[model samples]
Target: MTVTLSDEARQYIGAFEEETEATAVDCLVDDEFDRLVFVVKAGEMPKAIGEGGETVQHLEEEFGRDVELVEDAPTAEGFVANALSPAAVYNVTISEMGEEDETVAYAEVAHEDRGVAIGKEGRNIKAAKELAKRHFDIDDIQLT
Candidate 1:
């Protein structure tokens, strides 16, 4: 599937690369969450983050919006794992759901990290779902 980004998103991507010198696979503008999620190219996450996350903080300050960085993965399970970072997900199980052509992800997160994985108001999981749909055609995420 081809993804056509909006003008603002394209501009944001340009600015992000210029600011951080890290290649971004795609940019997600989550207006409802009042944040921007940059899907960075794999093997460049540390470069995108910079030392002590100074780059990300700078972006947040300059854009006046929350910024999240998720590393791009080569597969559906890997993508789901990357999306739930800082949450210590043990594994992600992908399975076809029903006859509606839906795909569901069962993420096994550490018990202690459950809240972190879900996030406040389920923001993290929702973002994961959205990104999964955008990049991997996954329909849902279910934390188990």
Candidate 2:
């Protein structure tokens, strides 16, 4: 999908790429969460994060807001899993439902990590849904 980005988001991506030397494919300026969420190239997560997370920390400080990263995946299942990081996702099943054919992702998350997957105020899942819809045309995500 060709994701449209705002100028602000574009600027953020440029800065992030310059600082980390990693490729960023998309960026979401999530004002509701008071943070910037970046989707970087699949294999560049470690570089974006830097050693001991110092790179991300510096970005957060420079942006004056929390920064979150989601590694882009070729498949919807893998993308969903990456979006809900810090949570152990065992599997993801994508299915089309109802007459409208709304696409949904059913994620099997570790019971112990459910809270983390959901995040405070459902922020994690919300981000996952937004990114999924943007990249994979997924309409919803349900934890199973």
Candidate 3:
């Protein structure tokens, strides 16, 4: 599915690319929490985040909203793993769901990191779901 962005979101992405000089693959704007999450090109997270996370801090201050960065991955499993970064995931099993025209990703996350995997008010998982669906056609991400 092609993920279309609004004019404002497009502009935000443009600004991010210009400032960070890191290729942005996709972006999601969480209006409810006033947060913006970006997926940067693989192996470029260090440049996107800058030394000591200064880049992310600058983007947050300029956008007047919280910012999050997700590193791009080549495989579906790897993508899901990256989406749940900082949350220790033991495995990501990809399977086709016969009931629907969608795929499912069962992520085995560390018991201690379960809550972190599903962020406050479910924002983290929600973002992961959206990005997975858009970029990888993964319908659901269940933390096992």
What TM-score against the true fold does each predicted structure earn? 0.96, 0.98, 0.95
Give one digit per residue, the lDDT tens place, for model 1 in 1-144. Answer: 555688899999999999999998788898888999999999999989989999999999998999999999999899998999889989999999798978999999999998988889988988889899999889999999
Which numbered prediction scores highest in TM-score against the true structure?
2
Q: Model 3 lDDT vs. the true structure?
A: 0.91
CA RMSD, predictions in order: 1.0, 0.6, 1.1
lDDT on C-alpha atoms for all candidate structures: 0.91, 0.96, 0.91
Candidate 2 lDDT by residue in tens digits, 1-144: 889999999999999999999999999899998999999999999999999999999999999999999999999999999999889999999999999999999999999999999999999999999999999999999999
Q: Which scores greater on lDDT, model 2 or model 3?
A: 2
Q: Please estimate how well model 2 matches the true structure, expressed as its whole-model Cα lDDT.
A: 0.96
User: Model 1: runs farther than 4 Å from truth?
Assistant: none
C-alpha RMSD in Å of predicted model 3 compared with the true structure = 1.1
The regions of model 2 sitting more than 4 angstroms off are none
